[model samples]
Every structure is written in structure tokens, then in C-alpha cells.
Target: MTRFRAAPVLRALVTLAVLGSVAACGTGTDAVVQGGTFDFVTPGGKTEIFYDPPSERGTIGNISGPDLMVDGKTTSLSDFAGQPVVVNLWGQWCGPCRGEADDLETVYENTKDLGVAFLGINVKDPQQDKAQDFVTDNNVSYPSVYDPAMRTLTALGGKFPTSVIPSTLVLDREHRVAAVFLKALLAEDLQPVVERVAREQ
Candidate 1:
């Protein structure tokens, strides 16, 4: 299996420049090389690229069953509806998720006031309590929804299936998927998406 990795800064810079030119030309719904290939509406009102990640795309809907506990209370994805929500599926055992934990916490702090809610769905972790402890130890303020059986994970079509950590889905106010990130996210990388959703209302 070939693992997909994010490009380095220099390569991404070149790709972004090319993508910008393509966007400026007013091409509709065309693929452009930008950092990574992505399907997006360019500033010129054209679809710049079509993002097709075998690991990221999946169906969207309400995830329910056994309640997920945050500080020992039942929780569901619906609780965060009527607002844009960022759902991060992760586990303590995943190294990449740990690498991105601090960044995610920062994202929660920065976007919480914008009416964007952040939640975690703990998946397939043998040490559930330890996973919870990781949250506490990291001082992650966002509430997490636990999925011991990986019902939610399977529902997401096993995107980022290996670690099953660091996979994040961003839902708009209507609970539609706006974006999905398969790797750890930096604050800058996530800012525009949150800002766009925040402006929806």
C-alpha cells in the first residue's frame, strides 16, 4: 500500500502559485495542483480541483447509539448541531494524533467563540481510560464523543483507517460535510474553513 504524505513547504509553495493562476483564469471545476490536490471553489467562482482521497471521503449523518461520555455525561453529535462542528476521530495510541493534539487544542480555543464546536470520537482504543487521560493531560477543553466499537469509524468508511487517529470532519451549520482532514492539522491550515463556516449565519 502506498502511503500518502503531505508535500514539503517548497513544493507546496510552487503548487499554490500554479493553483492561484488556474483560479484566476476562471476555469470551472478543474483539478489544480495546490499543496495537495483538492476540490475547491476558487476565489474566481470556479471549482479548482476535485479532492478524491481513498481514505477521506465518506457518507455524512447522525452518529448515535451508546452515548459518548465527556466527564461522565452522555453525548451525541446532534448536541452540537445548529452550529458548525468539527469532529475529530482519534485515539491515545496513535502517534500522529498525539503529535497533533496541541494544535487541535489551539484550534478549539481559537474557534469556540465563533460558534464552532469541536468534539472527539475516540475509536478502537484498548485503553479507553488512558485515552481520556490523554485529553486531560493535554488540557484539551473540547468535549469528546467515545465510540468503543468504532461504529462511527466504520460509518466514515474507514478513512485514515490505519491510525484512525487525526481524522477530522468539518460539518457546516446544516450538518453537511464542508471538509475532511486525514492528517494532523495546523492552525493556519484550519483557519479559513472555520472562518467560512462562521460567516454562514
Candidate 2:
């Protein structure tokens, strides 16, 4: 996703407004809202993990869209049911996305045998070929949902960050969140997190 280019004052005011609203409602401390979509904001360099049991965790609904690399083909979150999934929201134009691509693939390779799955969500790239090229150049084996308008993010429920590029979510076997990383990451940073979720019974 594109960086927030608003002036510092404007950005601060907007953030304050959102925080005030969330606080007023006694909602989650991590909750953030923009363009009518709810998401968990990862203040820079921070990660969020959910330790709630499966019975208490919020589940992500199925999100479907065209395949980024294959025309006329589609992919969905439901396809990976009963497995731990690493869901990444990225854009071909984002530098962090490019930087993390190889690491993501590495983690995917290492953990797939453990019943771990990986899915990418390509967002805001109007030129689909650029997104396709990104996957090809990075040798990404997993499928990504091409969502130029980021519409698929709604399925992640109110706790998912729709506008954060390079953000990641680790879901448990039942598709409920186990961890969230809103910053760019390397294999060393992502592998253990996926493994932890994969170990969940």
C-alpha cells in the first residue's frame, strides 16, 4: 500500500480521532478504522499475538479473488481450512514487500510439510502484470489473491489491518488469528511464528 502522505499534523489528528473513538467505545487497544474498515494497527516495529483459545478466538471469513499470476483463476482462504496459514497483505510497488518476498517463500518451504500454508494478498496494484512479475521473480510458490481495491480484506474481520502493506497474519488450524506482524520481516523473523501456530492442536 502507498505510504500515508498527509501532513504530520493531519496524520496526528486523524490518529487521535480514531484512538479517541476506540477508547470511548472500550474496544481493543489495537483497533483502528479507516474508510469504514476496521483493522489492528501495528505501531511501528511491533507485533500482536492472540493467545485466546480456538473457542474464544475470532475467525476470519472466506476471502476470494482472482489469482495474481493466473488469469481467469481464483483463490480463497477457505481452501486452506484445517491448516495453519500465513496470510500476507502486500503490493508489488512496496519496497518492504519486495524485500520480504524471498523470506516469505523460504518460510513457506520450510513449514509446508508441517501443515502450514501461505497465501499472499496483492493489493492496490492496478497493473496486474507488475504483481505477477513480482511473484515470478521471487519464485513464490504460493497463490495470491489479486485485489486492487483490497476488497478481500473485509473477510479478515474488524481486527485485520486492510491498509498495511507487507503486514502478516498467522492463523491457527481453525483460521483464527494466532499472531500478527505489521512490519516487514525476514525468514528468521517469520519461521518460528508459523511453527508455533503450526504446532497448535
Best by lDDT: 2
Q: Model 2 — which ten-residue stretch has the worst lDDT?
A: 28-37
Q: Please, what are the lDDT tens digits per residue for candidate 2 over residues 63-152? A: 677778777676777789789999899998999999999999999999999999998888899898989989989899999988887776
For model 1, the local distance difference test gives: 0.63
lDDT of 1 by residue, 1-201 (tens): 123343566678899999999877643321111122223222233221122332443335565433334443556567776888887888888788888888888887888888988878877765667877888888888777666556555444323343435777777766556676766777777767776866665
TM-scores for the candidates? 0.64, 0.75
Q: How many backbone clashes does candidate 1 have?
A: 2
Model 2: lDDT of residue 127:
95
TM-score of 2: 0.75
Model 2 misplaced stretches (Cα beyond 4 Å)? 1-45
- Candidate 2, residue 10: the lDDT equals 83
The per-prediction tally of clashing pairs is 2, 0
